[model samples]
Target: MALRLKDQLVGQVVDGRYEVLSRIAAGGMATVYLAADARLGRQVALKVMHPHLAADEVFVDRFAREARSAARLSHPGVVGVYDQGAEGGTVYLAMEHVPGRTLRDVLTERGALTAGEALAVVTAMLDALASAHRSDLVHRDVKPENILVGLDGRLRVADFGLARAASASTTAASVLIGTVAYLAPELVTQGRADARADVYAVGVVLFELLTGSLPFTGDVPAQVAYAHV
Candidate 1:
């Protein structure tokens, strides 16, 4: 992407180890890249925080939470993180790289999944969340895009970047930490989330998998959030 120019990562090495190959995806806080581990001689997914977020002191804790959360999990249903550190303006987390499509991509291509198909997809997701919950981590975002359905047919729930890494629900100054459409009611009103909140999000994902649409629609974001509430 054009943004990569501003990020002197792709085609260059970082920390004298990972050789950022190409940009994979971009999100609100970070841009993910496919990279080669020069020492290990293997491929890994590298998530580098946006220059703004990396430079902002406000997001440091949240960024570290993602690194710790993913690094702690070794479940088959969840992607494993290998390393995390910052170099100059780049704060990056290197993790497992999976080749595949996301649940959202599946829904877009197939128009919706049958009951059986949807169940299989969500069950894998649930197992991953169950692992996270048992580890005292609550994934704040559990949307379809964060769930990867690998080309080898494995389901991997990802992006533990924003979370309640503590066992208790957290109150954040930000209005929300997850996708507004899948946010639970309590999260909307109180800005706190527990394991049940993750379950609720998965349930919504299941519904969307079946219908190929979100339950609530709106002309603007506020209206959709109101519908969710």
Candidate 2:
């Protein structure tokens, strides 16, 4: 079944500044919403951390750090994070709203893309990853679902929600958090990732875009993990 935002989030206000309009996407640690910025008079993408993650001190610290660091990065291909804070019990990030569909959505509808189109999308995503890498940030999650193609055909990488500073801890949990199909082998085997890891993910995405199937797939997480090997 197609995921619907309304079924995931309804009546959630983040930080009292971003009024959640509707759910856009849901992930393991957070839920993204199309929200209205009460003070700014504009639309914004609000990411509210899952209550379990929000209650974890380490996760909260990492979330705020990544939000602040991502905000410092100014690139057309990278989603801009404007604010990060907590209110009531919600921890959220207010980011620039890109009006378009995710690469995953496009792939789901079209099946596969032409070689040229696939290259275009991958190139844009790599550029964004390069920028993040240069700034010592690693987008732990790099997949079609995290890349958005705006109306102008510009690709913007979203969901820095899973990003962690290069200096942060790389535990087994972190390695398993990203999408199984697009995860780099190094991430799975060593719990270590860098710019090259991002490159590997882009390659996996390209493979999917060209073949309409993942390089690896299985019925369960363990089976998927073994497929990566």
Task: Give lDDT per model, in order.
Answer: 0.78, 0.77
Question: What is the lDDT for 219 in model 1?
Answer: 78
Candidate 1 TM-score to native: 0.89
Best candidate, lDDT: 1
> How many residue pairs clash in each candidate at the backbone level?
0, 0
Q: What is the lDDT of residue 184 in candidate 2?
A: 72
> What does the lDDT come to for candidate 1?
0.78
lDDT of 2 by residue, 91-205 (tens): 7888999988999899999999999988888888888989888998778778888898899889999866465532242342543545777667777787677778788888999
Best by TM-score: 1
